[model samples]
Target: MACVGESNGLTFWVAEQKDYEDVMSISVNIYGGNDYLPHRYSDWMTEPDRVVILGRKDSKLVALESGFVVDEGRTLLVEGLRVCASERGRGVAGEIQRFADQYMQQLYPTLRTKRQTMSDYHSSESTKSLAKFTELGRRAILSFTGDGKSFNGFISHLKNKLNSTTGLDKAVSVQQMVPLEDAHHLKNILLDPELPKRVQLPGGVIIQDWQPFQPIKGNLEILARRNLTWLVNKLEKPNFLSFYTPPYPIAFDGGSLRFNIDMFGTDLDSAKRAFVSHFEKVMEKGLLTGKIMIHVFLDQSLWKEMKEFCAGETGLKLWREYWEQVIMERDVRGGAEGKRESNM
Candidate 1:
């Protein structure tokens, strides 16, 4: 492992596989067990584009952060940031982030932007009033909890409702967007000429499974690694689209799967149909089992309508009310004057 630098009495090291256990140990209770580090740390270590940074306070592991180069190395995504519980209230979080920004600049001189995403709760508490960051946009997250059996039952009910829909609704087309198969198609749709006027995307970025990706060939290569389900309304004139990031187990209730359905369009009817279609795709693969936490992310305008439809029309109760994920970015190519401490 390579040592990066020291700051504010904290020493930095390029985290390796050996540091996995310690990272998990310190982050056990983080996010109330919904932490993604434990699940992605192993892969992060092996990914050529990712660098996990460990911060030590007086020789003890006290914090961890990762910077992954994406958007063709023009953007460095800051993720898996967590400071050990014992180190809370101190400036360790900010210091480590500041140090990280500097270190990443040295490692990747081509990086022009630094980006991070946070829960609405955290974003509200952050000092965004400063000129260091730009608020890209936010997606509303509707949550629900159920076991595999319950989810199966819900899907079955949804099929019946869908079957009863009019012929016009049945004609609604949904297609899967794969990397090699649909790379150009995906790029054109995401970076379409009409997107700016429609403003379908927030800041022209695709935040999938909590990772904000730009619509570029390099970014598509990064995304192609995941087992994602992409559904669009049409190949010619697409308006609504959705992608379901396959479920991964979270440390909630012994262990439960976290499934995310990201809907990009504001069409209430299409969003609802795509929601069921994506769930059906998962069910077809027999991936649902045990306890599962479902999170539906969509445009803020469609949150209330989608929530009502899921509960009243689909019979799924809301696990929690109204959570939003805030996506933010800052120019690092000489625009940011000083240190940028991400509160994500």
Candidate 2:
């Protein structure tokens, strides 16, 4: 409701519900009303924890940015940003960003990490502007389809990429799954008695006595009372699988899930074995109706181990082209940390 500044008589103001129509119009002009910009401004502005801002001149909306704080208020993820075509290069985007930065400082002084993501098809100008605010953290390449494929197909695709002597050397292998059920498949896998309840290492080292985690019910009751906020909370902590001595997690975005494994102790090989075992156990469950997209984080260190494990005639052999999306990320935090190379 407060005016942040002006650009050539264009007044940038903190957005209110009245600006929703203008917001949707700008989004349609920019993203063609595609799934990319699917939500209306009210969808964000009405959220209790979100920050929405708009820039306008003479009652005409010029630019917009929407974001939310996550990671216990340490990180702010900018979800969407748009500028009217007529206002391009007029410094409207920069002005709005400055306003956002000030707002964040005032609201959450402890905020440290500011992150954002851009899809492969984003305009070059959009990409450049995003890079200006936050450094590239990680790139995720993903594939989506309705065709049903076994979970093993996901592993096989990565194996093929690894086997490629010339390509996919820098990608971190992972999968994003959208199950037909409520993704209870993961919860079932964890509780299945037939599966090994331990991290079985390469040398038979076992981290045993697995137990299913039930998130603390402190906020569950409150969250249940507030549905939308609860969903947002759940999406924010997608990787929260279970509470263990050493916590490992999975990210659930609506119907989809993202799994990532990283070794902490010096026993890297043992960690890798345990991780692979878990991967196989989940994949063994298989999918019922929908397709799961596989994503690679181009710089994951585990690719070497995976390649080594899947070598030779006894190893799992796979071919490429089963996946559809490839991501490349560059680290601009602390000022460009070398260049990122990818075969995506």
Which candidate leads in TM-score? Answer: 1
Q: Write the per-residue lDDT of candidate 2 for residues 1-344, one digit (tens) a residue.
A: 57766655667676788776677677644422122333335556666557887777788887888756544555554556778877777777767765675576577776665555444455365655554443332322222221234445544644454435335443644332222123344334333332231321211111111101112222223222222100000222222121111111112223333232322122224323333344454455542234222222222334455445444443233322222111222222222322221111
**lDDT at 155, model 2:** 49
How many steric overlaps does candidate 1 have? 0
What is the alpha-carbon lDDT for the whole of candidate 2?
0.41
Q: What is the TM-score of each candidate against the true structure?
A: 0.89, 0.45
lDDT of 2 at 273: 35
Model 2 error, position 256 (Å): 19
lDDT of each: 0.78, 0.41
Residue 168 C-alpha lDDT in model 2: 42
List ranges where model 2 is wrong by over 4 Å: 4-9, 32-40, 123-344
Model 1: CA > 4 A from native: 128-131, 162-184, 195-199, 312-315, 334-336, 339-344
Task: Say what the RMSD of model 1 is.
Answer: 3.7
